[model samples]
Target: MKRGFLEACVLAAISGEESYGYQIVKDVPASMGLTESTLYPLLKRLEKAGCITARSAEHNGRLRRYYRITDDGRARIEEFLAEWPSVREIYTYVEGAHHDAR
Candidate 1:
């Protein structure tokens, strides 16, 4: 679930415009615990899944890979949004159960 959430967040970050690794890290909320170590592999996975496309551009005389969301990636964001109600329902049930136990 966390992985899926991270993927959705990353996709949303780039959904607005093309973005590079460091920018993506900055775009996603710090509370999400996004780190350089976690982001690269996740970017590769998203690329592999065809949810995003990567291209290289020179910035400060060095290559920077930027990612843009693909059609599938947008669909993924929508899908995650659609699932929110169900997730919320489960959370509510769990919270109620925990209070009952207490």
Candidate 2:
């Protein structure tokens, strides 16, 4: 179980490029689960911390807020990337152990 922190998931979401809130929430669960309450504050905090920036655009007559990773966010992602191997190793070991037990 490589459950990541909100910042990690949010960072992962924007690693490739920018994304809207709904897209981030929607895409995350496919690989890592995230709920509205969990993601929203993280976004706000990141915005305040200068790790991300937000912009609004009209989509289907509805204004959607999009979050883009800034230089600071990219730097944070690099830090996370450096730490990820250990996290991944734990999950892989757990999964392997479970399979071996069967």
Clashes of each: 0, 0
Best by lDDT: 1
User: Candidate 2: where are CA atoms >4 Å away?
Assistant: 1-4, 85-102
| Candidate 2 overall lDDT versus native | 0.82
Tens digits of per-residue lDDT for model 2, 38-95: 7888899899989999999999999988899999988887888898899889889999
Q: Model 1 has how many clashing residue pairs?
A: 0
Cand. 2 TM to true fold = 0.73
Q: Against the true structure, whose TM-score is highest? A: 1
Query: 79, model 2: CA deviation in Å?
Result: 0.7
True lDDT of residue 72, candidate 2: 95
Q: Candidate 2, which ten residues in sequence have the lowest lDDT sum?
A: 1-10
List clashing residue pairs in candidate 2.
none
Q: Candidates' lDDT values, in order?
A: 0.95, 0.82
lDDT of 1 by residue, 1-102 (tens): 788889999999999999999999999999899998999999999999899999999999999999999999999999999999999999999999999999
